[model samples]
Target: MTGRAHRDSEADRIWQMLVGLVWETRGEWRRKVSEATALPFSRVRILWRLVDEPKTLTQLAVSTSDAPATTVAVNDLEDRGLVERHPHPDNRRAKLVSLTPAGRRLIESARRTVRDDAPPAVQQLSKTDLAHLRRILERISSSER
Candidate 1:
């Protein structure tokens, strides 16, 4: 292969490896959070999204990227006393969804699960190696913006 073609192939391989690593870590984190919270990953995600402030159902749907699924998840969360809806001040037709005290406690537990369950490989990294990895990852993240 030409030098350019060889470089491109190597870059593709590295990109795939990085993507795989990220996905694996994400899946593991989700699993741990689900186990700790006794809720599906989807519900956990919605809870995390609502952490900052209340959101309309439409807003949640947009953020979650699945309107129908968001509706169903919100219904379930509401039924379980994890969330409550209050009339939106600006739009009489819309209601804003916010976490209840129970929801806050559960999400806090999930967050702790995430913090305490770092992947073993990452946990094993030396401080210097971790710093290098963080810098490289931050550079990659900033390049997209």
Candidate 2:
């Protein structure tokens, strides 16, 4: 192989490895949260996002990768009484969804599980490194949209 082409291939392989590692770490952390909450990973994700306040279904869809399935998930959560849907104040056609008290408690417990089980590499990052990582991730996400 030509030197430059070989170097490019190597770089691509290394990038893929890094991406895989990050995904594995996230999956592991999410599994722990799911177990602690007795909720599927997807539901736990929704609950985590709703911990603070109500959000529109569109917002939830945007926050989660499984946008198509969000409606069904919301319906299930509502059925279980872990979440509630209220009419949006400004948009009559839209619904604002939020966690119920039980949902909040369950999510809080899951959050604790995730925090306690954070990947060592992530937990050990220096504050500056963490900030840098966050900035980089934000830039990447923004560029995708």
Candidate 3:
């Protein structure tokens, strides 16, 4: 085997590390940007889905991994003025969720938020190593979608 580790051998380690990074990245960004601890990371995801086009809560659930409480969360954001619900033109039974003007502003802020929390050790990575890391990660994840 020439002492090289096979890619599959790292699968479990990679999965654990990936989920851990998601929390670390989100927690750090939240601390650096907003005082609100309920940001949920789920809300950012829902907002991202609505960034281009509005969707109903059910659709948002489907898009957001069929989250169990998407309805409750959407209602909470609507109450906070972060999201606006508009009447669905084609389906009266459904409502479309869109980011408010304020929501747009919040997500714009989050874009910058993520960069602010990136670890300094990551800065030590060579440009090629960094690019390879990103490419490998994305390539591996594309199969999940």
Lowest summed lDDT across 10 adjacent residues in model 3 is found at 29-38
**Considering TM-score, which of the candidate structures 1 and 2 is the better prediction for this target?**
1
Report lDDT (Cα) of residue 32, candidate 3: 46
**Against the unseen true structure, what C-alpha lDDT does each candidate score?**
0.90, 0.85, 0.77
| Tens-digit per-residue lDDT, 12-95, candidate 3 | 688888788777666666564443424777776777788888888889998776556898788888888889998999999988
For each candidate, give its TM-score against the true structure. Answer: 0.73, 0.70, 0.68
Model 3, residue 62: distance off in Å is 4.1
Q: Best candidate per lDDT, number?
A: 1
Candidate 1's C-alpha runs over 4 A off are: 1-12, 26-28, 91-93, 113-115, 140-145
lDDT of 1 by residue, 31-141 (tens): 888889989999988998899999999999998868899999999999999999999999999999999999999998777656645678888999999999899989989
How would you order the candidates by TM-score, starting with the best?
A: 1, 2, 3
Report the lDDT tens digits of candidate 2 across residue range 1-145.
Answer: 9999999999799889878877877876777777887779898778878888899989999998666799988988888889999999999999999999988878777656567554688889999999998998799789998
In order of listing, the candidates' clash counts read 0, 0, 0
